[model samples]
Target: MCRWLAYSGEPLRASAVLLDATHSLVAQSLDSPMGAETVNGDGFGVGWYPEGAVAGSIPAVFHSVEPAWNDENVRELSRSIESPLFFSHVRAAAGPPIQRTNCHPFRWENWLFMHNGFLAEFAKVKRDLTFAIDPSLYPHVTGTTDSEVLFHLAITHGLADDPVAALTAAVDQVERVGRDQGVLFPMQGTIAVTDGATIWALRYSSQGRSRTLFHSRDVPTIREMYPEAERLSQFGDHAQLVVSEPLNDLPGLFIEVPESTIAILDREGYHHEPFRSAA
Candidate 1:
């Protein structure tokens, strides 16, 4: 398992969510109360679109196998850079070796992706899933984790055009392959992806018990709900976050994304729709 967050709206220091929150991603990396694993020390990565960049520009990436809490580079970069959209992930490797190549927040073109779960009995279906990816995208998969494979799978199915539909199709294929190989409850996970503008997150499992996920309530609502909380003052009206768990314990600040749901967050705001497999 792993923990990750996606932010959209208002260009601000990445550290606002990655390092400065009450229970920030760095804090979660060390003591995650809601993640499947408490210590996600395997590796970490951050991907963010540069300010004022044109459409289709690939995000800047920083990856390290060091624990997020101990990584000075992560802290420095988070404080120095600001972007309207970005992703941060601290991984707990289920099987893949801990290495920069196996880090989360994988990128392709203008898109960034990360996952916090596994393909049950992946070895049984790895071949089927690997071969299913479109040949053109196959060569671009550089890591050996199911997460990276899933990203490419989504790309093969048209993630760049329709992220929700493509991810649904990708999950459907993984489950179908796992079932074919006799693995029960084949998929389990929460996923976050962005194209430097809009963010799409999913919480689902074949058995209907997905990992935890939540998105912040709108800034205006949060300010009114926690008027005395000083942290609320730091965020702009457009600030929004979708995470594997709540960044802070402040009541009503974050809304739990329903199981089997796909959440979408953009400049317009956030909404969720029921997720269904294409297969």
Candidate 2:
């Protein structure tokens, strides 16, 4: 399992959420109270669309094989860069080797994708899944992790045209392939994808129990609740976050995303819909 956070809204330093929060993404990397593994030190990555960039611009990514908390560069980069939309992920290698390529926030063209789950018995169905990817995308499958394969599969299934539908189809394919190989629970995890303007997050599992996922309460509502909390002043009304877990314990600061649901965050704010495999 892994832990990740996606931020969309105001242009703020990545460090505001990555390092400055009470239970920041970096903090989660070392001591995640809600993650399956308390320590997710296998590797880490961050991707962000530059503030003021034109629409559809490709986001920048920084990846490392070092544990996030131990990496000086992660600290420097997060503190220096500010983005209106960004993604940060800390990895806990389940079976894949620790390497830069295996880190989350995988990018293709102008879209970025990350996942906090795994495909069960990946080795058994890896070949089938790999062959299923459109050949044009198969060339970009640089990493061996099931997460990367899942991203490309979504693209092959039409992520650019319709993310929710594409994701559902991709999961269906994974479950169908895994069950064919005799694996009962074929998939499990939460996922987030963005194209610099909007973010789409999904929480689902083949067995019905998915990993924890959350999104921040709207900034205006939080400010009204904690009138004197200085921290709430940093974000604008539209600011929102979808994370693997709540960044802090503050009541009403975050809302848990229901299981088998897809949370879509855009200019209008957060909207959720039922999400299940098409199979």
Candidate 3:
């Protein structure tokens, strides 16, 4: 239940999409054609936003409990750190506990988040959504995943003023405590977030069958429909990507993020709202 990718355009090198795409993101942690596990080796993370900080601060994470395809310090720090905002994940430990703070894009203060899905009955609705988080963001939820307690319950219900209504109020507080303890389809995958200047992705679940997600159909309109694929002339003019699949296999390059959407990329270009409570 893990596979993630998020970026905010034009700085390149995080292996040009987390390891030179052709299904990269470290080759989908070893072949994940839309994961429910096809070898997400259970521990990986990468977070960026460090190229002269000091604006709002906080964005420089690099976790590993090994197995981001055998991390050699995540391939020498994703080819020597370059950023325009980033987030990466590759773990499939369904219920949690693999270590390294449950490896993900979870951070705060300049935001960053990640989740692939599953909160369904997280040990009986995880103590009523962890005592309804907000005791000053409850010691920054140092890990014990229900995807980092749904990213600190969307930073205590207000991810800097409406991140899809703070993630639909953390899925309406986990569907009002997993439907009074019956827990039908509580929630499922696909969530990505950022604050190093706008980026948010979400697809939904609650049994509407949500899983696979994709994006990246704008890189100058696939560089004028593959104008001789010069690696699509190195991304800019609002480069975009929201991946959970399709890193390459051209033919009009990637789309399909429906079923309760939210996808909004920055630097202007790419929108798709309507997951406002499944509309």
On lDDT, the leading prediction is: 2
Candidate 2 yields a Cα-based lDDT of 0.94
What does candidate 3 score on TM?
A: 0.34
Tell me the tens digit of each residue's lDDT in model 2 across 14-113.
9999999999999999999898999999999999999999988989999999999999999999999999999999999999999899998999999999
**Residue by residue across 1-279, what tens digits does model 1's lDDT show?**
899999887788999889988899999999998888899998889999998988899899999999999999988999998988889999998998998989989999999999999999988888899999999999898989998999999999999999988998999999889988999888999999988888999999999899999999999998888889887777889999999889887878889999999999888898889997654
TM-scores for every predicted model: 0.98, 0.99, 0.34
Order the candidates by lDDT, highest first — what do you get? Answer: 2, 1, 3
> How close to the true structure is residue 255 of candidate 1, measured as C-alpha lDDT?
90
Off by over 4 Å in 2: none
Predictions in order: lDDT: 0.91, 0.94, 0.82
What is the TM-score of candidate 1?
0.98
Hey, what RMSD does candidate 2 come out at? 0.7
**Which pairs, if any, clash in model 3?**
116-189, 117-189
| RMSD to truth, every model | 1.0, 0.7, 16.6
